[model samples]
Target chain A: MTDRQLKIIEIVKQSGPITSEQIATLLSVTRATLRPDLAILTMSGILDARPKVGYFYVGIDENNLIAKKLRSKKVEDLMSLPVVVGEEATVYDTIVTIFLEDTGSVFVTDGGFLTGVVSRKDLLKNAIGGIDINKIPVGIIMTRRPNIVMAFPDENISDVARKIIEHEVDSVPVVEHVKREDGKEGYKILGKISKINIARFFVELAGE
Target chain B: MTDRQLKIIEIVKQSGPITSEQIATLLSVTRATLRPDLAILTMSGILDARPKVGYFYVGIDENNLIAKKLRSKKVEDLMSLPVVVGEEATVYDTIVTIFLEDTGSVFVTDGGFLTGVVSRKDLLKNAIGGIDINKIPVGIIMTRRPNIVMAFPDENISDVARKIIEHEVDSVPVVEHVKREDGKEGYKILGKISKINIARFFVELAGE
Candidate 1:
């Protein structure tokens, strides 16, 4: 904004709804000279104009700008590397992978296709259920496909965020359809969009 | 944006750097009448004006607007009710409470003062460690005070988001300093700021 434009705002703020003629008089400029500045101020929602009352200081619509920026972002830009294990892997091994990867959950794949997901809570339930975690396959305790919430690369970050909240899961696997070696079609794990990613994104959005 | 303002933008976007006189000719209005609209378009950052040249379509600075809105929010406005348990509660019972409440972790309080936090991962390790979960207190395996990351009511959500990402914790207990029954000052659990809250907030911001 120019110095004169800012001054116009100040004058309007202090003595509005004051007429443009009075403002031009204070600035020693004709109404024609101040018309453009007034137009900018009112058009940007920084001031309100009435037929007889003149201009009133009105703030910008911050939420609209925020929403616009948020909507422009896609899930692919924010997802993190997914931790994966085979469906046949023992529950003990899967837990070890979770610790090694420092992830809240691990995706389970069969023939390199996503089949299920196992979380800390699920493993804890089984671990305390007196079962032999080393003897049973992780697939036995996992939340299987068709039930697992999934995300695509082009999906909106906001939509995936809603999925994470509604499903109450720490993360959702970003997947894409592919053909396995045996010619069966299934989703292949591409990445994982988790709360950590969302938190980090939030920090970045605020920081920027 | 007004119809004339949008029409002005379209003209600038298609034929800019076109002069105000040319734009006025295209719109069938006098140059003086188009001055305010051009001023509004340029001031709001929708168009760029260059002296001795003409206007150019310059999109809004979305990040700045998003950052402003994100920074305006405080943690207290987005936090969820924290699940709390006494230090004497059994690990098994704590796990039960976690399942019942569907929370990722529970705050452990001693004499109404926060003493520790026990997460699902913590319980999972102990549950599989061959310890008697039914006989041991949850405090025995919890992350104790002074080591726990915490949040206050007035903290910026973005700062807490950084803490959550840096600490790799699903949530942090929001606390307030209070005098216990024994006259000792300690933090009292108030609520929890979790990734879910962040995710939900993100959805709302985008939705709005």
Candidate 2:
């Protein structure tokens, strides 16, 4: 901040809700002289300008600043390539895919549209239940569509992080609505956001 | 920040390496009048003061401010109660306990000291690999001690979070060094830090 800007903040802090004209008079300068400084102060969120009332002191809040910056980050900026499988793939194949990709869950698609989600937990339960892993298709035991928590490319990282926590799921597929060949609405998988992503983001935030 | 502080920053930014007396002279104020403001600016990292020279403009870095706040959090402040089981517990029983507690992994202890960690992935892998889970003790399948990633109460959250991501593990046990009956070094599990905790913390930071 400049000395003039600092002086302007001091003026506002003491007599906030004071007009720009009054501040100019107190500083022995014209309103035009204080224009740029006032602009910088208010623009930086150090002061609030109310019509007919004047600029009010809105000192920098570090917590709110952090929150604002975090919210500014969108899902598209941090999402990773989604691990996906076809609905017709066997449960055993899905499990193999999961291990190969090292993902917590895999999205199931039918004709290239999301149909279900199968997590490690789900596969474990089925694996222990005496089910024929090689015979049963993943579509038979997966958490079917409309039940899966999903994300969009433009959604805020904070919002999606909340979904991951609230849903108690390791990850969610970032999807887009599309019309299937059967003329039904379906979601096309784009990316995935998981706890790992959030953790990495936390590391990134701290490192930066 | 106060107006005088802002003014001080401006003066330093424009004519830095200029002494305090010179700044006081330019502002038509006494050195005493600028002392508190200068102190605040320097303390907040907005200015760097040299012994012989005047204050230099360090400026406020929002990213660093966020990083400092994040690093300020310690593991003990955010860790959750660890889900533990004895080494004698069968894999089937451990799996049941995991479902009952809704945890991703369970710490295995022997004589009340951490011995190993068994994650859902390990159990699932064993479950589908034709093992008799009911007869196999979790100790046989767990990632044994000395190979486990562990945390301490005083470790920084950023450092632990980095460990979680780099190690590719779901969580790590917060342990304390202890002497066993035979005088062998052992770790007593105190808590666990997981992606869930980190995600929750991310929410808390963004919310606050």
Candidate 3:
């Protein structure tokens, strides 16, 4: 979050369900500047308004609105793709690929169907106790049914943050907003956006 | 994950349910070095062990053991702390703290219970339409019931990546490993672990 936004929230809390017009006057800022903040607060589910009265704080659980909004954000906007993977040939071959690709998590797909996921830990755990890394089918050791976390293309940073909170997962996969109509290919793996990505994205956005 | 660990896995995957002594030989490393990785893999549920036969990969889709391990790594370890929130008197007041603190996220706790969270976007959303930021209580306007993400203290880089992949949230609230025994107060808030932190940390670790 930016400093200005924080300042604005302070003002609102100090006063009672005050009007935006009054706030603009008190803050000496134009309504236009304050507009974005108001929208964000409402989206966060913290703001409640009456026909004649102004907005007031709801409950502490109001963050749910923000969490819901985060889910709406597309993973594509956040994902990076053409994911690197080691080919499946033999156990030894897969072992070499794990190092060459240099990824903690690697995707294992056959004919591009999203077959499975493999991580260094997966390989290591299986390999302990003199298990064969070279001969065994990598498929046997790979994570089949890899948990797919996704993100939408157009969504707010808040929405992403909320999703992270709600799901308690680290990252969401970014699938293309629109897949091929034919459905010949599954959703292209755009990349992944995790809670960390959201954290850094905002830090950079805030110029902090 | 570390390169040494990967090497150990490769040796085992190629060798088979061999002894750790055999694994140590193939990797050209001591058994002591391999022990930690072996133990980790076995405990993570990726590798199943036999008293005499040795360990084997349980196959994929069982639950990303490594990812799950890293998922437990706390955001507090990765997150920044003394989180510095503005006086939570108004909805608008949050903006000031956001801007001044130069932080995107702020925690709100009364008597250290973590009542709510406020971000710059939260302030922006509320400040619009001449919304009075001061009058709106941040606790009321702030995000309540935020999705909680956690991490353990002994997290590796891969674990960080997995958390991002699993949770898809931007920021994780790093809390103490041991929760408060009696009440929530003992469970102190640590800094945060963000994607950026993970990325940066990995970059440094990789260099080493």
Task: Point to the candidate with the largest lDDT.
Answer: 2
lDDT of model number 2: 0.89
lDDT of 1 by residue, A39-134 (tens): 877888778899988988886556766776777789899899999999889999988887888889899998888999999889888887878999
TM-score of each: 0.85, 0.73, 0.34
User: Between prediction 2 and prediction 3, which has the larger DockQ?
Assistant: 2
DockQ of each: 0.65, 0.31, 0.02
lDDT of 3 by residue, B1-208 (tens): 3566556555666666878888888778888987877765554344567899986666323122222333444443554554645335676455555546645566676655555566543454455324555576777776664455545455543554556556554445555534456655533455655565654432322221
Off by more than 4 A, model 1: A2-39, A49-55, A180-182, B3-36, B49-55, B180-182
Error of 2 at B117 (Å): 0.4
Clashes of each: 1, 6, 133
Worst 10 residues of 3 chain B by lDDT: B59-68
Q: For candidate 1, list the clashing residue pairs, or say none.
A: A40-B40
What TM value does chain B of candidate 3 have? 0.50
- Native-to-model Cα distance after best TM-score fit, residue B118 in candidate 2, in Å: 0.6
- Cα lDDT of model 3 by residue, A129-191, tens digit: 246665777777766654544455665545555555554444445545444556665644556
**Using DockQ as the measure, what is the rank order of every candidate, best first?**
1, 2, 3
Report how far residue B34 has shifted in candidate 1, in Å: 7.3
- The better-scoring model by TM-score among 1 and 3 is 1
